[model samples]
Target chain A: MSKEFIKGNEAIAEAAVRAGCRFFAGYPITPQNDIPEYLSKRLFEVGGNFIQGESEVASVNMVFGVAATGIRSMTSSSGPGLALKAEGISNLAGARVPSVVVNVARGGPAIGTILTAQQDYLSATKAPAPGGFKCFVLAPATVQEAADLVYEAFDIADKYRTPVYVLADGMTGNMMEVVELPPMRELSELPSKDDWRVNKLEQDGNFRSISSYSPTAEGLQEMNEASEAMYQQWDKEEQRWEAFMMDDAEYVVTGYGSSGRIAKSAVKELRAQGIKAGLIRPITLVPFPKDAFDQIDYGRIKEIFVAEMSIPAQYADDVRWATKSKLEIISVLTSGGVILETEAIVDAVKERV
Target chain B: MEKSLLIAGFGGQGIMLIGKMLGFAASKAGMNATFYPSYGAEQRGGTANCTVIIGDDEIGSPVSRRLDTLIAMNEPSFVRFVDRMKKGGVVIVNSSLVQSKVEDKDVKAFYIPANDLAQELGSVQVANIIVLGAYIAATGILDAEFAKQVIAEQLGRKPEMLELNMQAFDKGMAAVK
Candidate 1:
């Protein structure tokens, strides 16, 4: 329960270390450079390994290598760097290696601005891999939540034997806030690697090989089905979200990450001004928090405003999917690294209702 | 209640440090605070600014459209953020570098010669501290003693610079008085 005022990136790195992550590999990218920079020193102090990989490609592979040893490992990147690691991420998914990847996202189509944007929502939630695989994507709206989710990410990754993602924007990565960090987990307290890891096979007299390739069509089909079943279980159990003042609301403003934070503020102010507005923030973006939308009384709701920092509204599609397009969806969007302003959201709500 | 402060200046003027100090002090005072810095290639010499929010509860957005306070260390920064100040918001300007006048009828403006004051204290690098001192005096947002203690703890590593920074902070407080 030690509390400290720290930057979001540094907080995530520290939380990961406390969660028993022993290996970190990353390259420098804006908004997320602090994660690797902080971990480079913090990891060594904990008797862990830190490598400044030559590139994102090399860094993710390094993570894959470390995860194969049954140690918790992580890699982080921003916009363009995330694109480079996509292949490795897909490979990690196919191999079903338990790893954590953080994307302190910035605006993007290709090499977009370095400012905060939720442009990676679609990439993070829908198509993180090539073979229709999904990631356990967690989007945090505050630095404290970011730290907590990151600390829990390791256990979730290990539990499912899959890659879990902490999808934050630049604002969440760079912002400084007071966070109560979790208790540190010692190296010896980590889960044993005897069952599947490639290490200590000689001692245990049990051999294991890790690979993404399936020899036959049946094998690949079985693998894909197992992955899909895991995703379904995740949707059933791992869905996390926050519903703010939705008991009797006419306008529901929905968002995630920094955008969600702003929209919540707008909703609060709008409520103060006698507007029946509330917020539905999806903390788990991959499972999509469809239940949160399901709980929304569409009969009482007039329109659902999907606020985000991406033009053409990337997360709005998920909102539509979650609600099954039963309610009218209005997108409040901005691109090119510009944050969604509170006034803009307030004005949007005012104009509509 | 939540209070949002924006500190703006040239890259070399310690704009980020001032915002961080306020955020740290707010957290130390048993309040929740958030400090968000804008970083890019422009960090070398171009304009740099950071937004800090302090509240009794969890802060929603780190970025604010209309701020409760704006500390402008240069002319460009003053012109850039003055319009973003909320009605009756406090505007602290470093008169040494910024010559603009605050004309907003609803704004409360304080002009302090932070650079000159820091020079008299024997270093222009402490100009931001001087402005911070005046800010504490003007807005009464943070206790002066608590802020000084934060400065001491932050500069504890560089023991040599501690005395001068304290003097600059005192001078800035005096300037506001």
Candidate 2:
């Protein structure tokens, strides 16, 4: 298909449909309401189902229910809304259900602004719920990448028997750009779920019991170990990141999502001024892209600037863990729904240079 | 080449649409374009703005620290965003609504009576289109024909409005020329 002008949220919705997401359940939330709004009509055209549940909790549970049936299911929300889905997400994790959740995050500790923010990084990567479960988090800096990530998220979720989050901010959700959408997957071509799906119980006498809890401690331990195996496999295989202008770089700017995109511009401007700068943009927050940090020439690299839209520096903690305190890390931060400024980032680098 | 533009006005003044048109046209002309809109709780009559960046290469930031062009459709918008323009940038002020003069002498300013031209063309809603036309003529960053095609695609759903909008766009271009 040719490139078409589309908003990020809408592109993600369309991509999900093309990826054979036949069931969608999400409540309305600012910055991400466009996802449900687009799907409410678009899904019907493809003989799919879209439900705007009474609340975020209901919506997530609905997606979980659909996912258990071996159907591609998805739900999306902003920060506070995503918080409400946390318990349901944990339920999906415990049940070993494959689902896609989208968090078009906004600024917040609680009920904050309806503007863009990356405050949910720790929440999405570390612990989505209480049981120490993690979702494979994919962060997209551009609308095209956002669509591409959402399309791939369903596959990753199914492969890992885990939920995958297309982590985006309101800036990416609200922005419009030219995107070449993915081609539609035929329903027949979709992967069959006969083995694990809750089907064939009556005819084939193959009973499948799906539950998020196990009564015995040993059973729960077995489930935990099984999940750990999958996570470890992802740790070795799923780390995704981008290194821009890293060859012979003395300074590095590290960020994810929209902040990463803005940092790229700052790197360009700093390079124009004869400052050897590069960018380390993490595409997957869960795998954390630690190898990208390893690729950095610590001998020549000076300061590593971490740019984020959150003031408390939630993403910086991951960057710290990845770099292992090899170099001094400076931060360029914006809070309370403020977009990260390229000028602020450039000036921060200049001060260190 | 990359150009960053800011279009600001009241909420009902179609500020966002003009920005979308520019971005759509740029993309159709085989350039990379990103349109970042200011979405808030405010409804119509509240301040509205959007930023558009068009470039030949991958666009790093959707928002610009210093805009290459500013199309201010109101007095407050003109006052609020004039200083964000680069030294050699250009601004197209809707003179009918923005009564103020350009304070930044370094930037080129075109005071087009967008509302007057729209009213003359029979609809006050086309004022933003007039400003869009002026922007195309002033900057020449995008092809005028591509912009006109975008107008027809965006506003042409209602066939009767297409010709009038085309005229408003042309008048806007004429005002700048």
Candidate 3:
């Protein structure tokens, strides 16, 4: 019940440790170094493993190695560093390993500014490695969410038999917040090391393995079938979102991460102007909860808009996919450290009205 | 409803601490709040900033253009956010660092000499709290008692500076009138 003033980055590290993550491996990157730095100090005290890898690639692989043993493991990075771990992420996906990865995203496309941005949206959701996989993405808009979701990330990764991303922007990571550490849930035991962990099975009878290459066609097909089924099942269990002030909403403002905060201010202003503007914030980006948008009564909505910290519009694409183009999707997308301001959103709503 | 406030200033100026304190206070008041700070250029001698949102309803967007009220501890923050403020919004400025005067008929602007006020109390670090005290006093959004309670609870983080902080807040609130 102790409340401690902590940075979002340190909270993530602490929460992961508390959530039963036994291994911490990561490479340092701006707005994210605090994650490894904090974990390196804390993991040892808790009798866990924490390693700062030579590179993002090696760090991710180190995580993959531990996950292979069915022990809760994690690694974190920002955009450019995440790019370096792509192959490793893909390898883990192919092996159906359960692990948590935190992306304290910064402005990107290249070595973009250290300021927060959601530009890595598509790349994160659609794993670009050899085998296609979509992570369970939780885009946290606040420092509290950044702190709290590390535990949730572990739970979801284990439940779905895939990676769970505690996706946050640099703003959320670097921010200082006196986050209430929620009670850690009793973790579900991993499919016992006797049976759950590979190679740990007695060499007498079983040859349990975690590998990108399954020697037999049947083995490869079985792995693909297993992952696909797991993903679909996860979509059902993990689809999460929050709809705000929508009962009388004439318009729905869609956003996630930092942009969601801006949309909130605009909604209040638009409502004060007698416009029924509400917010549809997708907390889970992979499962996306399209039904939430699909279920909205189009006749009640005058328009829909998506706001974010990217130029070409990533979540905008998800919004479009949800509605069948019944409602015209407009985006208040801003690039770099900036995001859509409330004034800009109000103007957009006014034009729509 | 969840309200989000972005407080911008220099790193050592306690910009992040100010945001975090507000979040803790909001939670103490039984309102859900989230404080997010950004480091990098903002902290390394650029313009450090953070956002704190508290509301009765779920907070939708975490980003804001103009705040319901702004506690600008520096000149750049005042320059960057002054135009974005709601016409009748509350703008609490640090008159010590922001030498330039800004006047608007629509907005109620309370210019507190935050740095000077804190220094008078023997520490300049509590300047952000001074500005926060001014925000509470001028806007009347938070009760002075609650602000005091929050200050006391958060004192452990900077135990040495607690007395100066309370005095700084007192001076700041007095300056508002």
Q: Write the per-residue lDDT of candidate 3 for residues A1-353, one digit (tens) a residue.
A: 86655677888888887788889999889978899998888888767889989888899999999998888899999999888998988887887688898899988779988887888888877764556677778888766676777777887787667888778888778766546676653445534445556857566776777776788999888888888887787677868887889887889998887777678778888999998899888888887888788779888774698888898788888788788788888888788767567788889888988
Stretches of candidate 2 off by over 4 Å are A202-206
Q: List, for all models, the DockQ compared with the true complex.
A: 0.78, 0.83, 0.46
- Candidate of highest TM-score: 2
Quality of candidate 1 docking, DockQ:
0.78
Our model 3 lands, by Cα RMSD against the true structure, at 3.3
Candidate 3 per-residue lDDT over residues B74-171, each given as its tens digit: 89988987776767777788889897665777877787888888888887777888888887678665667767788887774666667767887787
lDDT of 1 by residue, A1-353 (tens): 55688999999999999999999999998879899889988999988999999999999999999899999999999878988999899988888899999999998888888888888988898887576788899999999999999999999999999999899989999899988988999778877766778775755576778877899999999999999999999989988999999998889999999999999999999999999998999999878789998898877885899899998678988888889889888888999878789889899989987
DockQ, ranked from best to worst: 2, 1, 3
Report the C-alpha displacement of residue B9, candidate 1, in angstroms: 1.3
Error of 2 at A194 (Å): 1.3
**Tens digit of per-residue lDDT, candidate 2, span B80-168:** 99989899999999999888888778999999999988999899999999989999999989799999889989899877899899999
B103-160, model 1: which lDDT tens digit per residue? Answer: 9999998889999999988889999999989999998887888788889988757876
In model 3 chain B, the worst 10-residue window by lDDT is: B36-45
